[model samples]
Target chain A: MPEITILTEQELRQCAAVDAGAVEIVSDAFSRLARGGVQMPPVMRLDVAEHNGEVDVKTAYVPGFDGFAIKVSPGFFDNPKLGLASVNGLMILHDSRTGVVRAVMLDNGYLTDVRTAAAGAVAARHLAPERVGTAAVLGAGVQARLQLKALTLVRPVERAVIWARDGEKARACAGELADELGIPVEAAADARTAVEQAQAVITTTPAGSPILHWDWLQPGTHVTCMGSDADSKNEVAPAVLANADGLVVDSRSQCAAMGELHHAIAQGALPADIQPAELGQVINGELPGRQAADEVTVADLTGTGVQDTAIAVRAERRATELGLGTRVQA
Target chain B: MPEITILTEQELRQCAAVDAGAVEIVSDAFSRLARGGVQMPPVMRLDVAEHNGEVDVKTAYVPGFDGFAIKVSPGFFDNPKLGLASVNGLMILHDSRTGVVRAVMLDNGYLTDVRTAAAGAVAARHLAPERVGTAAVLGAGVQARLQLKALTLVRPVERAVIWARDGEKARACAGELADELGIPVEAAADARTAVEQAQAVITTTPAGSPILHWDWLQPGTHVTCMGSDADSKNEVAPAVLANADGLVVDSRSQCAAMGELHHAIAQGALPADIQPAELGQVINGELPGRQAADEVTVADLTGTGVQDTAIAVRAERRATELGLGTRVQA
Candidate 1:
């Protein structure tokens, strides 16, 4: 067995801003996935109760690689009650040559956060308008914060508005993020006010009901929906999706099942012929991302196994080089 | 993320025989699996090269449980060359409630090997006829040795015959195992000679070609084949399967694809309606295991994810209670 080094949540947070090493891995995974060189097993879900759902397990096997990542993310019930975050996991790296497990990284949804955020950046870089300067963010959760951080990396945002049900949480989140990114971030009174003036809007709430209104979106606005990972969860209104010029998703199959697109299609708001291109195709320049600067574009940001594998691989290497955590040999 | 405990290979080996707690876990896993309460995903395989095959990533989710185990067993080419055992892996146990990763167990295939061996024992206890004494083992590798050890735990074996292509290696394995178990063991020069006098036989080589001949088996002899796990791997002759009065397997789909039954069906020797009983059913008493003392029975053993999850859960608890490894929290 190979020597394995683990990275804690603190280590992962410390390395979050400097994850250039992980970007390459994420890019490679995306390329391999787009080329059909990777075998991702269907994402299995187990319903804990009628109201709560958890991703039972998600896994992928890349042909040339020895190991794969199995991800399990439980529901978000405890987050609000315990003052703790939901969605934690570990990525195990196995040796492809000897079937030996090489490393285990405590992703804690950190890598997931990074890769998903990077993917958001990737989407903004390709799908958002060239002159994207104003942005609106819905929700004050970790995903909402990361999405903003990642969007700023690709697009030059001059001002940003944040809106959440909890006024204090949104204000604090806006203030902290604004200070960190050196951008003007103000808390908006409602979703309509937050998204109406922005060129790019991101909905990151875990609300099952539609939060973003169709009338709030401007003519050239690009909307990135990051919540709604389950069948019952919806972040954007069906009318908003129908008004978009083009829809892009991380994976068409995923978006058509449990994502926001699924709800849109169910409501007959999105046509059956709406075949969204995968994020990889846009990143690889295989498909056109955003056709016109003022075109209304939307990218359904359902996560993928490729992202988990990519970031886990990178984090494992970094943890090893830095002697970040305890080493366990198996 | 939850606190994670790391267990190394050396630590596992040190606790192997002494850890009855881990054995109970293996037992419970089989029981739970037998009860139809566990969901084990299909095992995927990736052939990196012509001679190297890796057991690709596998994940399992049990409903009502917060975490799942992701297993990655890489290719096994370098182990023999490096004078080390091949097939090492780790299991990451995450919190089913929060998806926070809880522990990383460096199984080093120790838990896998043990659970597999325990499954063999379970099969023998249910499939084999009572009053069995002599046993024949084909191949003197690690699995062959474990099979004998586990079989003896459930059956009162008086003597054993071990056979391998290399006589010296077989002799060494037989001598060492016999000394450990206090049973008479002899190294057989040929495959047929090994099974000629034994009432039970186990084939554990990775030979693609047939090793066990049908004519060498007695009428009532029980055969357990555990070597064939990939599309290109087979151990027993198809004629042996044809001659068996009853056939059983861990999973029918898996057996039809990669087990000994796969070879038989490929050669048109066994009909598609062969309808092997699932090991789970037999264990749960839903299907009869062994009927007649003079009936030839064969059990095709392909490893399962339930075993990995069961063993990992058990090992984690035991290791924690014993304070056996280093724990890191995030």
Candidate 2:
């Protein structure tokens, strides 16, 4: 009988610590995605309006990978008020040869957190300036903290500035980052204060309306916005995309549906001369990023199935090395 | 922490005997589906070409039900030759309000088979004439045998005729059914011979091209074609759909994608005067079925998500009542 391994959330937490290896794995995934041999289907979404919840299923297969993952992510928007998490999920990995169940990673969004943060670091490694400066983060949520932690691995970021609608949450986030990264982090008075003096600014808000404006961007600043993953979400204004010298998105088709680019195109604010390029292309060096030292760049990240597949494959390997999880003849 | 009950294949096999209750449950699911309150997403398909296999994820939510089910079915076409079953899967039952896993049914496609046969019975119950002499099943597979058994519950079927690509397999299937159902069964020389004298006919072959033709069907026959769930599979000729006196489909949207209706539409074989009604509409009395005793009625079932959810719910309840699963904290 074939054994199906069950990797519980606690076990996943024991093995998956976001590190440079995760960044490299996801970076290679992006390169493969740009190489054009992967098959990732469009996400399947089920919206439960009565419970203010939505579940998204994503899957992908890289031709050379030993296995692939189908991740189920559910967002219960009203859960936070009820003292529960808003997002939770698991990933199912299957054998590529026999299409049999290999492992079930019950991460409850932990792997997604790691992969998304790793993507942020990849974006920074390719697009952010090499010199030392403070990075600005516009949110005090889980993503805001993870992005800053990931960014510190690639760039010489000495400090960070945080901005959020809730000022107290922003202050608490700043303190947590300062202690964790051993860098001076401060809470910004507003979004403009956060953006005006940073080398790389990351927007991580789940705002319904634009939270950051274009006029506040500094020259040569690279902005990575990772929060606007749905149609109703917006972090930066449409003008911000038009104003950037180069605009890159994780997936063009996904952005056209629920990304900031879709909002910008709807508002007629995107520039005609600047054609958007995929981040994978930029990472693979097929497309140019930061052509000039003083040119502003923006990358929108809505997540991709390739990253999930990559991370799941990596997690399964790590679990084996650590001798974690229960194996059952399922 | 919540406990997740695991119903293994052996356990499911011990409890999942096809009965009239499954028919009623699925019949009600179709009614709920047609009543327009269920939340079911489009199917998510992942292809594993290396294994000559594909996996489908299906789910549905009926409004007043306490829980719903998401089923993952994988078809490894080459496995049977490798000494393993070609089809296997499990269903996950989750609390609708909390979005938490309540049970995991390791059915190995047993629940799907039972539910599918139950759906066929439900279809025959509503569409078939009050009495049937002999029902012809056009396949010599697991579904072919189960469908005949299920049909006996709703109709007075005393004999069966089966035709398959391999005449030897057809004869074996006939022998098995005769021993199990206490009915006279025979292997037909051809598809025409199978349908010519039958009162009710079922097409259950996963044929790539048309195997059954419109001209072979007899008057007063009710045909339930349940194999063409994918675009590449077509069991009955398009002309068969055109020749039916009345046509009812599980879902019009699904039929337009992968059912016999799609092929019929592609070939321009559909009639201009008849608008296809949903099976739920016919079951709920919102539409008519088999208008005359001598009419040729066709029901195209592309297997809806509601049926999966309903069957899973029923399986979970029956398992609990019988104390048939191991509940482990996952």
Candidate 3:
């Protein structure tokens, strides 16, 4: 029988968080992905329309890693109505050599959130100005707060702005984040106001149409759009992609299909034959990220399977160091 | 917190097995698949060529079922040399409505074997001769034994024959199966001899070249090929498919990619545009299975995600009834 470790959500929280180590881990995964020999298949998604729910399964095998991860993420949009979290899932880490499962991280989507936020930090680290005076985020959801926190780890974000359609929610989130991060976080009066002053901007909303306009961006500002994961969801105007000095995506094929790049191409704002650099390529120094100090850059993150593998491997290693999970014989 | 039932291999063995009930469950699942509305995605696969191993992930969401299943199956063919089983993995069952996991079945490939054998029985029940006097299998592996045992549940298989490249292993398997199933069994000298005397023949070997020829099949014989799961593996000659009176498949798209139909199409023995009827259609009376007693019907079982969901649901329900699993909070 193979011995398997089971890590609960609380245990996972202790081992992994939006910290410097996570950003480095995700950054290294992107660098490895760009170097090649990574087997990351297209994600598998199952939609249960009747219940307004969907489940996505992702996995990747990186050459140097001792183990690979398969993450199962379920999002039932209606769950929040029943006072339950909208997203819940677990990651199964398997030995790369023998294909035997090593651990099960029942983190209930914490690791996914952390990896997503860490990807934002990766983009900021490579594209944002070295000293960011202000960082702003659009949306007042869980990810909106985490993305800003993640940015603080990469850039010197002294102050932050929060903007959302729900003004009251935005104000409440700004106040909570202010106390949590020990930084000045104020609710912006409008989206334009938020983008005007920040050197770094992040969009984390499930908008079906564009919310940020092309004219709102300033030079030397780095914008990371983690929303627009589906074909129907768009947060940044298509014109913003056309006007940006540098455009990077987590996965070019995926971004062209479901990311903000998808919307840009569909709207003909970007040339049909245009080739955008991948974040991995930029991380590995194979492609240019921000060539000049006054150049505006944009990164479209459509979550990759490689990120899940990277984060799960880190969590399992940390848990092993701390002896945080229960061992079960299978 | 959701209460998750953890069922081990021993517990799963008590709940699910190769029997009449399992056949009925698998048959019903196939019928439902034919009826449509089941959300079964393409199987996800990861290959670790360095270790000579591969892993496949399959899932399905069947309507009207409270829970659906996701199965992770790993095949490390080299493990046998190290005194370990080549195949090992588990199934996870989730609540369909809420998208929350309900049970974890750590069956270590036992459930998969049962489900596969049950699928074989389902094919035999609908396609094989009504009263089979002699049944023959082409391999001396675990599935060869289970497939014959499964056949006995649906057809009156009085005696059986076993043939393999290793004659000693074949003879030993023949004796063991005869004693276990309470029937007369013999080891055939060659593939031709094994098919010549049996009313029903099953090909269960992982042969790269065809082992069962078209000329060896008789008019009343029904053949089920379950070994050619990958495109590189073949058990039945291409002529067998072109010459069969009734041809059926588990999933047309899957069969075209990696099953016997794939080889037949590649060999140009079968038409490229041919639309063979699915086995589900045969069971549901939507298509003809065996119109006459002398018709040579062949079923290409490529294995499907719906089968995993069906079998896991059955195992979980039975385990719940018997109180045969450990409950954990998630």
Candidate 4:
């Protein structure tokens, strides 16, 4: 049996140095998916409880491959009260040639969080203005923090405004982030205030209600909506989507059912023919991203399976080099 | 943080009592899936050439309830050379309520193999004749042994015939199985002779070529094809599928792509609307199974995501009760 390399969160965090290399890998997988080189089964989820609604599971099987990853992400709203952090899981890597076990990655959702943040960086790299200086972020959660960090990595964002329902929490989160990133950060009093003076905005809240309004967003502002992964979840108001000069998404099929686009379509605010450019196409240079700096663009980040596969592949390699975690022989 | 339950193959084998219970849960999941209560995403694999066409990464996410299992199962061809088992991997259970990581299951593919075999048994129970006195197993592998054991648990088989390219291995495997089950077992000289005397036939070889012939099967012989999960793989001759009185499979979409049915259709032996009954439908009484005692029935065992989820859920519960493996708080 080949030695299967296990990657933990710490190892994965260290591997971030080479993460730029993974952008293309993920881009290619998505391109293959679009070109019919990959097979992505329809997303399916089981409703374990009424409070949780439904947990969505999505799978993709590439041919001539022996490894398959199953992501079991549950939506448990009551977990915080139980003193547990939500969103924890591992990614299992398989050797497709022999159908043997490869390695177990105890990602604990760190991979998901990082890959998603990296995707945001990918989106901002191609879709944001060439001279991005200010960013407005909605929600004060971990994802929100990661989004800001990822955005700054790609764009030259010197200042960021954070907004949340709980003002104190947002202020504290912004203060902590400002210290970490060595940038100016402010806690906005309201959603409008956050967007008014920003060149780009990212919504990372799980609010089912529309929070970002079209009237609040400036013409040159680029919005990256990372929430609304289910039909019941919405972050950007439908008008913002309708009036945007350009729209981009990780997967159009996914965004059609969940994501901000789904809500926009359901409300009859956005036309069905308004095709969003797949982020992979933009990354591959097949499609133009952000046609004009002044044009309003929204990159809907509902997430994709290809990102999970890419990160797993990269993390496995990095961990093997760093000598992290336990190597299990299969 | 809640305690995480991890079950290795050894622990899982010690808790054999849970296997039967797992079968019931899997059966229910399949039934629900057939009834449209469950949804499964497509299976995706990432092949790393260093691993010899085996997938180094895999992700499967079922969207209905936000849960997915990512597994890195390597190739078996490398195991004997490396002095290890070919099939190994873990399953991660996520909480849908909060998208939190719930439990990490170091199944090492034991649970997967058991669940898969149980599915074969479920198919045999509904499709095979009530008096299945004689059975022929075409492969002398672990799956073949498990299939026979599971079949015996569901149906009464007086004798079993085993056939493999390697006669000695087949004999040894059959002898060990017979000693365990206390059933008469014999090694057949060839594939034709094996099915000729048996009322039910099972093909579990990983061979890409068709191994079984249609003419050798008896009128009432129920055939279960457990191999041929990839597009390049096939176990049953196309004529065998064409001549069957009724056909069934785990999932229609999967069978149409990579399952045994896919091979038959690709060869122009089967039509697009063959409309094979899902095993779940038969189990749920939503569709008729074997119509007559002499009817030739075939059930394609392509596998489904529902089985993975069901088994993962059951294993997690059992491991929790037994206090097995490590627990990590995320």
lDDT by residue for model 2 (A43-96), tens: 988777788887788888777788888887777788778776777767888776
Top-DockQ structure, candidate number: 3
**lDDT of each prediction vs. the true structure?**
0.75, 0.85, 0.90, 0.75
User: Clashing residue pairs, candidate 2?
Assistant: none
Q: What tens digits encode model 1's per-residue C-alpha lDDT throughout B1-330?
A: 456767776775654441345445555565666575566657655544532545455555554444556665665675678665656666666554555556766766676777777778878888887766789999998888989988887788989999999999999999998998899999998988889988989998999899998889897899999988887899988988888887889778888988999989999999977788888788778888889989889999877777666666666665766779777886
List of chain B TM-scores, one per candidate? 0.92, 0.97, 0.98, 0.93
Stronger candidate by lDDT (2 vs 4): 2
Docking class of 2: medium
The CA root-mean-square deviation of candidate 4, after full C-alpha superposition on the true structure, stands at 5.4
Worst 10 residues of 1 chain A by lDDT: A46-55
User: What's model 4's lDDT at A102?
Assistant: 60
Tell me how far the alpha carbon of residue B252 in candidate 4 is from the true structure, in angstroms, after superposition.
5.8
Could you give the candidate ranking by TM-score, starting with the highest? Answer: 3, 2, 1, 4
Candidate 1, A1-330: lDDT as tens digits? 466666677886655442445555666677678877576666766443422435445656665544556555555565546666655665565554454555555656676778877777777878888776679999998878988988877778898999999989999999999998898999999988898889999988888999998887888889999887778899988987788887788888888988989999999998876787888887787988888877898899788877776666666656656767666555
List residue ranges in candidate 1 displaced over 4 A. Answer: A18-32, A35-41, A44-85, A94-102, A213-215, A237-243, A263-275, A316-323, B18-25, B44-55, B59-69, B76-85, B94-100, B237-243, B262-275
Interface RMSD of each: 3.8, 1.7, 1.0, 5.4
